[model samples]
Target: MSDPILRLSGVFTDIAQYHILQGVDFEVPRGQVTMLLGRNGVGKTTTLRTIMGHWRARAGQIVLDGQDIAGLPTPAISRMGVGYVPENMGIFSDLTIEENMILAASSGPIDRARLDWLFSVFPPLQTFWKGQAGNLSGGQKQMLSIARAMVEERRLYLIDEPTKGLAPAIVSTMAGALRQLKDQGASILLVEQNFSVARALGDSAVVMDDGRVVWAGAMAELANDASLQERLMGLSMEAGH
Candidate 1:
């Protein structure tokens, strides 16, 4: 209802000659989770990349807090208060957990209070604080990636497929952490495939099909409408259970 923290209007992305996003329009409300859902290969990931300036938009405007960010470089965008967590978790294999955190640390005195809060939210991070990131399990890697993002206190986060290959138990843990982040007033645009996980984390849903947004509404509405889920998400309500 109010001005969104991130707004994508008529966003069109082209990878060389191939167009990925076609006239995609969506708004990510501040301090709320917005789930981006679609069948595989529908450009959900591309949308996240485009937003982060990894892939420049050939047309459209990406506005963040009333400023145009579409034309900015990726590093510029990151400095503009956006954090990104890629699907691979983006943990440096050779670096220790602390080293990875230091890499994401912006040019300022470390916020001990935020670090303590992050460690409190993720205890494993405290235990493996000295361990190499590659040595940590998949779930732990995810926690580190998220913690790295938190260290900077960004205004918005673009998380891409965070639960893609995680175990069921780990997925549950990640979902819980996401809920905690949302409760803490983090504006998140989550690219997710697991319907249950998305339902648990999201306040709103934006369903994309063939690189275009076909549905946008409250998550509960899409969760309850089995027909819409089946038609747009190719998911059966029975399958979710």
Candidate 2:
């Protein structure tokens, strides 16, 4: 197997007085999606934040492309070619979709070719290009958030619950966009509550509980065994059947 683009070894994170993310370890392989799965409050979101440097890891290492990034600031981490989409869909409400795209183009001006590709994947972005982002529907806003992250080329994407609160049809669209991203050779570490989305997109799976990794294996193995799925994630893939 290829080396992981991102790896966390014994990572610990703290939020104010609360201690979250205790010794988490996982690997996101190059050019594939790794599903980070668990129930609510299992430190899934915290782990993503810690990787992005929004929350500091008090102990352990966050290695990206063979370099330790645990001590780096958020901007430095981002500059290292990591794109993050927080669970809150971090788009500027007052800005136009075009402006948001421009702001996210940290490397330089938005490439017209890349912009056209993104619009093809998400046609709503083109339809609402001149409109204020706040006026977009929830699904369109989610598309914009993911699109913002795509304005520039990045080695890895850390996405938190892209399917959260989205309608079934919209979730289907988001899943297709993610697959297209993978096909274009992007590595992704995804946190998703919806088992169907996770099962469909993940090449590997990591299960976390109480801030620690509890299971790691192939997505197919996890999906094939309902008992194992229940033990690790408290649900079966049967819902997707």
Candidate 3:
């Protein structure tokens, strides 16, 4: 809505001969959590990948903090302060938890205060400080992935399905940790299927269908209208929430 940290305009991507993003467009407002919602196979993961430079956009502009980064290399984008946590929970399985966090802090050594705050939010990192990342449970690994992104400060965070396939209790934890990020003035573009989590954390909502933004408005407007949800997402849900 204001001071958008990231903007994607007319973005198109093709993997081999198959088209993925067909003129995708959206903006992530600064200091707010924008939920990227859509049914499966609508190019949500591909959109994130394109933004992070894992998949280059064939056309259009991806403006990050007033600079176009659509075709830049992944490391260049990372250096420009865009953090990504893919759906796969991108962590080195054989590395210790400490090692994973260290690798995530590419700018420099992680500050002690930031690490303390991460430990406060994700206590398991402290509990398994010496354990390999592969040894942790699925939910714990998810926590590790998010905590690694929070290891150092960044201008924007692109997170994909942080709460996927987790228990209700763990989902609550994940949402709370995200709330902490929002509270600290971080801008996040989150892809979440769990209506509960999306409703709880989103300030604005963007609904993508067939790789294009079909709906963009306040999160409350989208949350209160079940018919719109059904039309855009192909299912009605959580009427009054």
Candidate 4:
């Protein structure tokens, strides 16, 4: 059975005076990736922020493994084992790469085997471990952001636009690393603008428009249906652009 690791029911979130998410609902099944897709400004990032407790839900349920965590503090939610990589690649520019990783190991020490695997997937983290994070290139910053999330094993990962603005080769490398993460049974909820990456990794998908789930189905089904893709994605599928 495909049990949900996380579920949101009729979630409504506000940003200042503006309401960003109106009754957003979805489930991230255990041990699989669920792509959250839509054109720009469709509440995708807001949904993620709400889940991570960076933004408060105005109404409805944000359930994690059957626990209602709608109004919990961000640190409390994080302690419950939800890892997040924000759209801006939330890394401390002033900190060294090593210091960032050290902080991400919130539960305990970073596992040596996991650190080795992360270095293999993202060599720059090893290459520039002691360097200031602000000195890294865009792609390297993204790699460090993701590696920071994997410094500890978590119940679920909420990753936003991880492959955005990266070289094709680097995108491929990132996809490969995520593939390995999936193979190891990590559950991921990814918000990706790259259609090819979304199609490649998402087991199931949820498409949002105007702050609500407009479509939800298997990723392969969406990928094969050109007209459906046209109707749902429009010209938004930027291959890897």
What ranges in model 3 sit over 4 Å off?
A: 239-241
Candidate 1: worst-modelled 10 consecutive residues by lDDT: 232-241
Alpha-carbon TM-score of each model against the true structure:
0.96, 0.98, 0.97, 0.96
Q: Residue-wise lDDT of candidate 3 within 179-216, one digit each (tens)?
A: 99999999999999898889989999999988788999
> How many residue-pair clashes does candidate 4 contain?
0
Candidate 4 segments exceeding 4 Å error: 236-241
Error of 1 at 181 (Å): 0.9
> How badly does each model clash, as a count of residue pairs?
0, 0, 0, 0
What lDDT tens digits, residue by residue, belong to model 2 across residues 1-241?
4699988999989888888888998888999999998889999999999999998899999999999999899999999999999999999999999999999999889999999999998999999999999999999999999998888889899999998999999999999999989889899999998889998899999999999999998988998999998898788788762
Candidate lDDT values, in order: 0.89, 0.92, 0.92, 0.92
Comparing candidate 3 with candidate 4, which one achieves the higher lDDT? 3
Question: Model 1 clash pairs?
Answer: none
By TM-score, the better pick of 1 and 3 is: 3
Model 2 TM:
0.98
Error of 1 at 240 (Å): 2.1
Ranking by TM-score: 2, 3, 4, 1
Superposed by TM-score, candidate 2 places the C-alpha of residue 35 at a distance from the truth, in angstroms, of 0.3
lDDT of 1 by residue, 6-98 (tens): 999999999988889999999999999999999999999999999888898999999999999997899998998899998878889899988
Model 1 lDDT at residue 145: 91
